[model samples]
Target: MELELRHLRTVRAIADTGSLTKAAAALGLAQPALSAQLRRIEKALGGSLFERDHTGARATPLGELVLERARVVLPAVSELQAEAVRFANATGALDRFRLGGTHGPLLGGLVDRIAAAHPVAPVSTYTAWSVDEIASMVIDGRLDFALIGACGESPPPLAERLTWEVVGVDPVFVMLPEGHELAGEGELELASLADESWANVPGDGCFEECFATACARAGFAPVSVFETDTASVVHLVQVGRAIGLCRATFPPTPGLVTRPLAGAPLSWRHLVGWHPRSPAASAAAVTVTGATRAAYAEAVSRSPSYARWLTSHPRFGTVA
Candidate 1:
């Protein structure tokens, strides 16, 4: 007989509660039925899954191994079921479009543009720090389109599979507390931050690579003393805990300031990308591209220094 989800859940319940009676109650099954089910499962595997005693039920070594797999499989199955339910409930949810991108105002703009014009379209939105993460989701059919920020002069490793449009280029700036001496300073050297702690979120993409490379070039390696998300990165810098990087278009956060590096050194080549398989991918790319460009302009308006840097370095976010 094929193993069912209930069989797995029953094993988990028995292991978690450590008592057959409790596990049966938790699973809403009678004690005899649960015991019979466990016996059948154990017989199929040619082993006893649980040991019975006066104290309680204990998983055998084999049972322990099975439970380890259960942890990973259960959650994924739950999410799959949930996603199925959502799509089923929402008519034409996947048929119209889906979008994903890096977090911040640009993502918001991209989502809004698509949603505004096709208000009833079955749309899904997601965000990630790594351009590769966004690109993978697009290629795997999770997202129809993505807007990503690449720090290097070229598209990310997976670019060949998808069409990319550079909506705008954004300079990378060091975010520091307003009270810090280097706040708003023009063209500061990377070495100046060498003595300071860095705050970074774990990412496999340009964020970590660029920080490592640029700091390496500056004759130092950045030590990320704290790992956190975008909002927390802002908070970490605001409290004078650490320095972090952001695109020039990041909206101004209170109690913090952003300064350009002297050489126009590190910036992201922003692109709106999509897999060509979808008939609507080209149209989605246009809407996302325009929204991203407008969002960059809005971000520039919020920071005068960043705008000047963008104006001075016309090739800031371009790839040759």
Candidate 2:
């Protein structure tokens, strides 16, 4: 028989209270109206749903079956109502901010800080491989801000139109497998690996262009065989299949090592960009950008390799 949510709620209430008068009172309905609803349900089912007893009213066999189903159905309906209320509260009241960054160190500490600092507002982060796509998202109002790599040779697109902030610079490192021929070398000269197959981040001009130019300055062009933007490029390097170029602040893992390129110039810089037109963009951008720079600084201070790289190359200073 076809039954509605109100019918199930009425049955549960009657079963709980053990009297139609009490059930109607609990449900905030008139006694006659509640009686009519129960009678209509019983008629539809083609059976008597309750038996009159000295104590009060009790369920018949058909009523017991309906009560069992109502026990399951009523609570589910209540829970759905609660969830609707929660969803409405979350999306309707809280301010939302969207931020995009390259697949690198920019997103690491900023995500946690934003969550802790702004408990009420919702923040979203996206990883983009291409600088052009990130710039487009910011310009089109799809993102409040974007954190991207910038180099002295090729900086990010127009900053005058959009408010730009230089968060930090991530030193580029050459990733190589454990026990590889050059793994034991204290430092690498970029020209030596001219013919070696390289793995690169697809559509990310920062790493690919920087590494290629570094190699060209050392007098050779690298042959890149595989291209991907995943953070696991270090894993590919660890397997000895291909060498990778990655940021210095990459998470530490066993069996992998990053060393400074002895002869190459340090040029990689990370910048945070936001559209001036977005109302919530400045505050959100400041929170994320500040956290990101602080994390990079703390991470570098703790890493011996980063320390050595910095000491060896004094000209490469902190980016604004």
Candidate 3:
């Protein structure tokens, strides 16, 4: 009959939602099950949290006091966990190489290289769609390094505690179906695809805004944009439903082709970051960054069209 963090969270949920049924739904519990749990919690606390009626549940005075304490306790506990991890990492207590990345080709290559170089050391990876999420994990010591991308000239995650370095740069390319009329061309004008609908993987970055600005400079706003996952973007382009924006190194897909825009109006910058205070800052960062650059080169070599395009555009491709 002791109260726990879960009990506090349940109480807070009931207060926030203002109904037992709503709180149950929010907490992913059956209404009856939530009620039973709440009854036990109330008995432990020696008072009911909410006065319930047909209208809805309303927090009593004791509930308000508990809610206030929960607001403090939850965040404190979270910060403590983060600080503990940071301390462990700073003290060299963590022996494994932990990497977090936004969905891309670089992570796998980097992981492979790290594992090969350090056969006895453990290496793990975490992938997410958002660059900021990956960067935050590095800052919180949940990851030793982060592999992410940013739109051209845009800064990496705003955290000052992390050090970010460019691993490579790539002109954003347009993905079209193999049968597309423009697919045969060496390069396409952004304005040429003015009327075409677009699809791209959704993420937290400046890419979407940069795309819109580039299109505006091309003298036409996109007719439609379907924000979705990478697989869906490929499917949309393959079916001729929409064109997709991708890295120049995007691997060749069976039904799709990627061609650079004539003016290189858009570009992606590959970056690797780590908390300067973490174990990765010693020598692992340099090793991983070098591996990532080499990986980018391999990716470019695999994409024949991109490799040929790089030959013509000397300024683009893997960063020095």
Q: Which stretches of candidate 2 lie over 4 Å from their true place?
A: 1-94, 204-210, 281-284, 312-317
Q: Tens digits of per-residue lDDT for model 1 on 221-280? A: 776557788889889999999987777777777898878876756777777787665443
Give per-candidate clash totals: 0, 0, 0
lDDT of each: 0.75, 0.72, 0.88
Q: Per-residue alpha-carbon lDDT of model 3 for 1-320, expressed as tens digits?
A: 88898888999899999999999999999999999998998888889888999999998888888899999998788768877878765548446889899888788888899899888888988999988888877867788889999999988994566899897899999999999999899889999999999999888988989999999999999999999989999999999999999999899899999998998999899998988867888877788889999899999999987888888888888787
TM-score of 2: 0.64
- Candidate 2's error at 151, in angstroms? 3.5
Predicted structure 3: lDDT: 0.88
Q: Kindly list the per-residue Cα lDDT of model 2 for residues 1-320, writing each as its tens digit.
A: 57898888888788889989899999999989999999999988889888866576789999999999888887787757644543443333227757788776657667676777787777888776777788767765566677787765565765645777776665567788887789888888877778788776776465556666677788987776578655557667878878877666655667777776775465577677876655535465666667767766766666677766777676553554
Model 1 ranges with Cα > 4 A deviation:
1-95, 223-225, 317-320
Q: Cα lDDT for residue 8, model 1? A: 90
TM-score of each: 0.65, 0.64, 0.73
